[model samples]
Target: MINQLLLRFKLLKDDKTLIIVMTLMALGLTLVFSSSMSGNYRPEVMLVDSDNTSESREFINELKLSRLLRYTETDEANAIKNIETGMSIGGLVIDQGFSDMMRNGKEINLSILRSKDSIELIQLRSDVQTTAFKFMSKFKTADMTVDIIKGEGFKVVEDELFEETYALSTYYWRYRNPFNLNSQVMDAQKDWAYNPMIHYLIGFTLFFSTFTIVFVGSDILKEKQQKTWQRKLVSPVSNTVIISSLLIVTFIVGMLQVGIIVLIGNYFLDINWGMNIGLMLIVFAAFVYAFTAIGLVVAGLAKTIEQLGAIVPIILVSSAMLGGTMWPLEIIQSKILLTLANLMPHKWAMQIISQTSAYGLNVSNFITSVLVLIAMGTVYLLIGLKLSKRHVY
Candidate 1:
């Protein structure tokens, strides 16, 4: 086994350019794509507060904390003109007497203005609507409390009581929402920070690593070409030993390439892989093993070395693009494409990484993704090993 492993390493050593190119492409494309996709540019959205009341002011303040877009104060005419002229992505408008409308139980007057519907526009609308909903609920609670006081005929200033009660209810709503009972849903929607560098960095790493693992797996065909497999069968070494050794070598070589890319991401690109190092390593391991297993199928399926070289890229890149490697699936409007993406392992891997690293999502949220990756690897490994036994070469 040791000799076989060394022999495999010797073979891989001769292909140093393959390793170097894969590593460089992973990091290089991340920088290029991220820059093209507004790596650090957060779109600015205009805010029109005609009411200029405390409620309206607080609503605008809430918008500033949103990760989706930056909110700035401006007039309705200015907001419309900029959106029309393409200077702004979108705008939110608060009609006159917005607070009175809320307190008086009249229509909730709010409007969203945009050039067209985009992901950012949708998120901005959601943020504006959600904020208004919270204020509406808080006022409802205040109104309920004040009505009860009025019925009791208490000698209290009604306006002053409503103000105090409204202020106190804000703390209650913030500290304890109905969804807090379930820990999973508590902060699920909180602070989904988007960085194109982080997105493309993880994306390209996953994309290019497939080339490394699959090419390494193709060494089985190489061994056949050099008559190494036939020579080994006549020796004391068993077939199991030969296959196991090759698997280990493939895993180690591929991991080193991935590790180098990750290091570049950390030191040079300033990417924080995630908070939990242990889990992140598991993610990397599971990803390699899954595709390494898939490579077995590739090796078994391709009848010639030329076919192996050509078929692997088409399969891998298509999977990557379908899995949201180039651009986010959120922007892809086609329902068929969205549904088909569920079949791609890269989709689950990207989902788990992006959520955990950027949003600080808990492990429980992505356990299913990890499990699916392992299951796919195991199933593919079995099929590949079986199919390789019948190879003509």
Candidate 2:
């Protein structure tokens, strides 16, 4: 095993593999960062407030606090014009006497003008309606109390009593709404703090690491094609040692490549690699083992380097695509595809990295992903070892 490891190291010492790995790391980082930090498409919403009172201003402020919508204060005429021109998706027209009606507990109406209806716009509309309702809850409660008192034949001045109760309630309702959303405009600063690039970087790293298996598998196939494997079989070196050596070398190569990329990503790219570096390393090792075992399986199947070169790319690309390397798995709406994706080691690896890198959570957050990866690797290794013992045709 030690002799094989030394031989593997000497073979990999050439600039070819290093140059390829570095080039890929550089290109992948550039594309991932650029694409992830690309401008967000915020849906424009023009606000037309006929009642420009303090209450109306408060409502507008609430809307501005949401990052979901790019809101602008404009007149009804301009808002209508923008909507017609398709410059804005929608407009919120705060009708005349909106504040007075809301204070007096009258049914309030808001004119929502949209250029075209879509699912996203519908969801935004729903969010706006819900927020408006929550904002008016205090007034609605006060109005109901006043109505109840009047119905009891009390000679209470409705306006004065309502104002007093509204004031008292305002003081009592000091706590923030539990459902209050913390939305920030997508600026460069915030983008740096919560960058999507980190996820993409981790994802692409795992995706590219699968290719190492191809190289390892090709090496095995090359030995068989050159009849070196048969020569080794006739030697005193045992079959178990040869198999163990191949597995160990492949595992080491995968780990070293992955580790190099990760270091480059963290230090050179200035990415926050979460707080749990130890757990992250463990996940990386599990993933490497999984893919390396898969490479052994490919080696067992392929007869030559040409065969490996053809077969490995297909598997790697397909697995990466399904495992959220090519795109986010979240956007894939197919239940069947999603279920199938879970079978890929890349998916579990990505999940573990995503949890640790983004959330800084403990092992509890990603133990399932780690376990899935390790178990998959163990199964693949067992099957691959069994296959590795067979003579290549």
Candidate 3:
């Protein structure tokens, strides 16, 4: 066991370049992505064309004028498909008699289908209604003017004159409309003041930390490949010490890597990690332990270091993207993506970081995230131990 510990340390000492590169990658990516965090994200709406008339075309154009939504014109079947598949937050269906309804000055309802209820969907509904009402009123005004002309005994083509009147009204609505409608979405959830530097610093820390931990944990697989594991099993020390030492060494190395990132975050990036030291310590420990166990689990599953190398990166990168490391989950409207995020350890770690971060968070939510990390770590460790039992003589 002592020999095993020394060999691990010797390997760690020799692999200084990998550790340094990982740290640099984390910090560099944080700086690069932090600037783009405020980039615009418009809700996407699938627009179904049922009328397929000039009136419907103009209305679709009106919908596109809104900067709040990115509308895509699709068939009714496709729109409904996108809505059901979670590819779209919602869909809007134009009535079949939309053009006739406009000509007759009758208001028509736009059908809205929501895949899931969200603030964006609510805002989309309002925008659609506003545009529909504007068109409705414009057509009604044209009808009134045509009626007045008929009453005054003017001999003019009714359809042509009404088209001219409606066109003029639409022009006035665009350039000379006095009512400036600025629609804002007020979300149901409580808002927290987000600090970008803190977020990126925390995010990259969690994301890139997996690289070193996984590589270090692969030493167990390396031992099996070199037949060192068998020799250790036959030694005087119990297998318990050998297993405990591997985890303890990996845990210590992970904590050191975190401390290095903290120092760099504080001094190099000028970030204050907030005053939640106790919460930070426990949560960070849970995060590191969970990932360490995950690495060991990867080790237990793989027959050699080469297999571990191939498996670890995909899991780490994909989990990071899903887990709010690349971006916050609050902006994501897909229920499917959100559900998938919960199954990843990266999500729980990031949630804990966000909760205890500089802006502060709800205590109740913070406790829940922390507990989830602990539970995840405990489960992974047990699974790793179970898998390792197959290798033990």
Best by the TM-score measure: 1
List runs of model 1 lying over 4 Å from the truth: 36-123, 126-196, 225-227, 329-339
Q: Give lDDT tens digits, candidate 3, residues 51-118.
A: 89988998998899887788999887888898899888898888799888777666686788786766
Arranged by TM-score, best first:
1, 2, 3
Give a tens-digit lDDT track for model 2, residues 1-393. 778768766666542574377448745775655564456856788899999987787678767766667789999899999999989888988988989987776777888987666434664687688668756876776788889999999999998888776666555654543346786644323232545666667777787777865576446667777788888889988888877777787777777777777787677777766644566678889988888888888888877677777888898889888988766676567899899999999888877676656555566757888788889989988888887766665
C-alpha lDDT of all candidate models, in order: 0.80, 0.74, 0.79
Compute the lDDT of residue 98 as modeled in candidate 1: 84
Candidate 1: the clashing residue pairs are none
Per-candidate RMSD, Å: 6.8, 7.9, 8.8
lDDT of candidate 2 vs native? 0.74
Instruction: Indicate the residue-level lDDT of 224 in model 3.
Output: 77
**Per the 3 Å backbone cut-off, how many clashing residue pairs does candidate 1 have?**
0
Model 3: which ten-residue window has the lowest total lDDT? 185-194
lDDT tens digits, residues 246-280, model 1? 78887887778877877777678767755455676
TM-score head-to-head 1 vs 3, winner: 1
